[model samples]
Target: MWVQLRRSARTHVASVKGVAWTLFLFTYTDYKTIFFPVTAFACVAAPVQSYTRLLHGVIWIWLNLLQCNSSNQYKSAEEDALNRPWRPLPSGRISRSQASKLRWSLVPICIGFSACYGWDVVLANAFLTLTTIMYDELGFAGHWLGKNFCNIFGYVTFEIGATKIIGTSTALDYTAMISILYSALVIFTTIQTQDFPDVIGDSALGRVTIPIKYPEASRKFTFVAMIAWSVFFSSTWALGTLSSLIFCVLGAYVGSRIYLLRTVQDDKRSYVIYNVWLLIAHLLPAQTRWNVLPF
Candidate 1:
């Protein structure tokens, strides 16, 4: 009986560790991406002064991570088994039943958090949650257009929720709208590069991502997207936004790297470059607030 109890305790600990690991991977990467929208709202609507507002933002970020990770893992188990076999769900570290229970549990908590803010916040959360369900369960990620649409809408909802936290008015100003649109464009154009590394798993699953659909043109498309990205930010810099200048330089550098390494089929290197590019892009809003670049 003591041996049985010890084994049970070890199982529990392992499950906990798996959950923690999954959460860390889901929340930590591009975690700063959440800050971009929140900061954008804070800059335009109101600065984050109170702990209450700050807590609201934090909750949104956490809830977003929970919702995305749970739903994506649940639906993508088969694909992950091929591409990311080491993931908690695919690796047998966490069972599908456990993941489902955890995923559903987050829904009520997210709603409760939103309720504290207002109906608009609740609606935003609901919209995001619903779309995420559709994106994964409905297999929208299988196609290029559907995937991009879902991603862009997800970012919009994220911005809406964050902005609603600090601003009395739900309506976005021109600058805020521009910022959101730019973010969406960035996702729509550049996010597909992430699929380059998963081509094998993606192809096996018949997922029609850019890399899968346009095998020959995918590299050129990414390069052009990066160039466009650089040009857009450079224009902003030209208008005296010093932060934009920094992004302009980083974007150019990243774009050039993409161009130079376009022929390399190394997934790890491609992912590293993509991650760095995304990090810099997400940090741009904070840079705008800081005005770190001296003109």
Candidate 2:
């Protein structure tokens, strides 16, 4: 009986690992866009949480990210076949039915993991779930307003839940709140950066993204938003002049290139650059948390 129990335990462990690895495949290309921002936000906001605790929180974040990515990719599988044929669905790594089952199965697991942190995290999980539905199922993603807002809100939920889990006290301070709110605005304004690369796919699908619906205006808007946020964030964070200058240059580089570069390949590279700037922007608060002049 003891041997039987041990065998069962091993089997369960292996199953859990299998599920985890499979989930990871769903978001394999999103490490920069999803993982970095969430990790940086948790690190900055949960200054008192030990590294081990923070790492655990990141694991939970990835699980939720996987679910989000799976749903999104499933919804846009056809578009993905055009723009990103290497994805799990387009590449034949997983079938539609199996992916759908994994998507729903992940909800309870995400909620269960959040419940370990408390209601706040669970609420964040709920919100993210709701946003996913509204974005994918409710036709929000087909419009510019819905897509931008959903992306920002979803990102903020990730930050909130991760911070709460690993926070010193699970209560955000004034700085934390302000920083997150500010980041949300930045993301909302610039979330369209992602859309530029998928113009062909989006247009083919009749998805009315900013870049597709208003190409000229959207490029100019990205330039303005990026530069504006660079200056404003330096001020808001009270960064030093030198720090501010560097940040502005990074932002300007991304913004200007995005405006000037019009090729599909150019947009793709520009989007990657934008994400790098975004990752840095998310990490800036670490300087704030440490009370160091990261400006």
Candidate 3:
């Protein structure tokens, strides 16, 4: 029984990370700047509370996604057949009904906690909910809409939501704007990097994505352009600081990943390394000077 329980817990954690990384990577900036507001909203005053809130937010985000129709399709049987069964939806570890019941149970807690911070924060959460619903249920992430509007929404919502909840009166400054811009560039790279893994699955589903739209010849240029922009934005955002140096190094690391994607034909390793390297690139700057938690 103990072993079974341990196995179950491990499976859930993998499922959580699978779904969790998207929100986590995109919101790293928020983790740094809005740490206080996030903690307050979660009613956590200490380090422990902050960690709890961080976990809670990720779980809440995942729950919100699971409650949406897109989560089911994305984590559908087809994907499970291709991958592993440890995922909550595909593995039969948790039924759709069970997941829905659990997610529904958290809605009140999510809303109430956001409201505790401020009405604006609550509104921000609403924005997040709507955006995610559209991204998943409407298939925005797999299409052009995700590249345009959804990209903006992810960056803007995190900043606005956390700041409003915290009641921070700080006006948007050059530094903050730079941070947002750098973060947005990173988000776009994430979207592109994510496409390599989904190429087979998305192609099977006839989903439009960067990989689907661009031919092989054109992909390398696009990959290079993304890496260049990453470097440009990071330099602009963290100029003259130790953060800038770290960002430059991380950008090089990400550039190598892009090169691999261009040259490598091995689907499985390329996809997995694309994801792993992306995480490393994002984590580097956050760990260096920012010490920001990724969502």
Candidate 4:
């Protein structure tokens, strides 16, 4: 019964639903659920419940993104305003009050969901809440050292959280170790690559991001290094684990990098497309099992 109206009037209702469902799919493709399939069962009862879980994931991801965005340094109160005028918050599509209210609302919902899983999940969610507060409210992420700590702790909490929810030690298994390493590499690469789009905005605001500190060419090189390392890691996994799923996942990453590399000269569409491809690669493993091919 979750109806979503489109920006157009004549669009069929199902079309609107399709777009809404797509958003939900991408939103649920987060670190916690990507490997583990926490929200998978919600689809069995009513397709609408899957949509709700997707909405929850999208809201959670956006809020977290906003929280991270606040970590950038700004010169004065005028420039330091967290929400830029073009953003959804400042644009009045959604009010600042609404965002704040929604953030608090989502926290409890996340906690409740985790509690349904187990106490360990609840504890992990508690830690995540604290970390979110520290980054958003306390301005800890602006500090260089604190930024690194946030990166490391964020994944740790994600692993712990999913482990508790799945009710298994899969998080600590060899597969989990590979996943953690893979995730960390992709995250760092993503952070670095994203700097290209925000370089002007961040530099104007006097932020001390890695890309702002280094040359522009270095940013491109960093991406290349990430691609190389990703290939190496995936090949290693295929060799040792011999999982066809590993190769499928690897194909996505390599294909994305190839696309990025070819279109690096065209920054506008290429950057966005590159990110879409990366997301596909990141989430592909979640839905399929890695089967080893018999030679």
Worst 10 residues of 3 by lDDT: 40-49
Record all residue pairs in model 3 with backbone atoms less than 3 Å apart, i.e. clashing.
none
Global fold similarity of model 2 (TM-score): 0.91
Where is the poorest 10-residue window by lDDT in model 1?
38-47
Model-by-model lDDT, in order?
0.70, 0.86, 0.50, 0.46
Candidate 2 regions with alpha-carbon error over 4 angstroms: 1-22
Q: Least lDDT summed over 10 consecutive residues: which range in candidate 2?
A: 286-295
Residue-level lDDT of model 3, residues 1-295, one tens digit each, is 9999999999999989865653333233233323333333222111122444456554444333333333433434465445434445565555667556554554565677677555766776677667656665676765754644775674456555543333233234344444445545555544455455556766676667776687463357545755575566455434445655555565555545554545335444444544443343333333223445222
* Local accuracy of candidate 2 as per-residue lDDT tens digits, 1-295: 9999999999999989876665666787788887887788777876647887787788888888988899998898999899999887887878888889878899999999899889999999999999988988898999998999899999999988888877787899987798789879988899898889899899999999999889999999999999999898787777878888998999999999999999999998998999899987887786666746653
Per-residue lDDT for 153-198 in model 1, tens only?
Answer: 8877877777767654556665556667777788778777677778
Runs of candidate 1 with Cα error greater than 4 angstroms are: 1-19, 25-46, 166-171, 237-246, 262-265, 283-294
Which residue pairs collide in model 4, if any? none
Q: Tell me the deviation in Å of residue 71 in model 3.
A: 3.8
Question: What is the lDDT for 72 in model 4?
Answer: 22
Index of the highest-lDDT prediction: 2
Collision pairs in model 2: 243-295
TM-score of 3: 0.61
The lDDT ranking, best first, is: 2, 1, 3, 4
lDDT of residue 25 for candidate 4: 31
Query: Where in model 3 is the C-alpha error above 4 Å?
Result: 1-77, 103-106, 141-144, 163-174, 215-218, 238-246, 261-295
